[model samples]
Target: MEPVNGYYEASMNFDMEHVRPFLSQLEEAFSLGLDVDHLAKRVAEAEVETAYGCDLHLAFEGQPVNMKFSAWIDDIDAPDLYFYVTSEKLAEGIDAEMEKFCEAHGL
Candidate 1:
């Protein structure tokens, strides 16, 4: 996707089994990830109808970072999940956050 207003935007696709791990990565990358982790846990274990989107606002060094994300699961024969994260302008940069985490954790 195109960077909106010079912010780095990215989306990655993976399956349901990777959910926990992915959340861990998010937890490492963003402050909002902790709340998202709890929300995801509730939905995953509840197995009931739930909203598929979460919006968050976090401040870094007194700067506000507003983020909105959508996630869904597909279970035709097996459960598969996808996520779309779009941040207009992130100070740390999504790419750098991801690369830094992955490199540190050897992921």
Candidate 2:
């Protein structure tokens, strides 16, 4: 939502009502070969105002792409959730594909 640096990011107001559906679509669209069950569980069990994340080793063109991802809240009392995906160094082609993927998914 800020700079187009080493990551693509997005944020929203947090709500469990939106968690499952959003995450379901996210995993389905971006998981590639990574199992996001742990991330799913962590987010599901998170307190309304809490934030956390983990690295997801998803596949891109049959090669593993490790991305650091986090779900953060701006305020504990009135949480405003945000998601960040980081890939410090990526091949040019892969970065473009990932950017397209994010755009397509409205991330």
Candidate 3:
């Protein structure tokens, strides 16, 4: 997969501890068709710091798609996380999963 021009992003407030669980859910969401192994590996190797983020590579409809997940602490002392998906299809799936994740965690 190569690079493309499309992009989408979603964000919300969540505790830092939820980051791993959210990634796990994301992995499950993409398990059926998308090869997000790179993303999973990055998430596993990620280090917690003041600001951290990672990108995953995938192919959507033959187009190379890039997805990024990031987390940081906001000024109000709340943890904030965001994800960027370069394909609408990928975004749709991830968005749905994120909504469920947020609702389940009461974020």
Question: How does each model score on lDDT?
Answer: 0.50, 0.53, 0.62
| Model 3 C-alpha lDDT versus the unseen true structure | 0.62
- Residue 5 deviation, candidate 2, in Å? 5.9
Writing each residue's lDDT as its tens digit, candidate 2 over 1-107 gives: 33466565555554444544555555565555545566656666667555777766676545666656566544433334344444333334334444554565575
Q: Which one is best on lDDT?
A: 3
TM-score ranking, best first: 3, 1, 2
TM per prediction: 0.53, 0.52, 0.62
Q: What digit string (tens of lDDT, one per residue) describes model 1 on residues 28-54?
A: 665553465665564365332333556
Q: Any residue pairs clashing in model 3, and if so which?
A: none
- Candidate 2 has a TM-score of 0.52
Residues forming the 10-long window of minimal summed lDDT in candidate 3: 32-41
Q: What is the C-alpha RMSD of each candidate to the true structure, in Å?
A: 5.0, 6.2, 5.6
Query: Candidate 1: where are CA atoms >4 Å away?
Result: 1-8, 42-51, 76-92, 95-107
Candidate 3 lDDT, tens digit per residue, 1-107? 22235567766765545655776777676653333454434434445545557666766556777777665644323456666777666777776888898788776
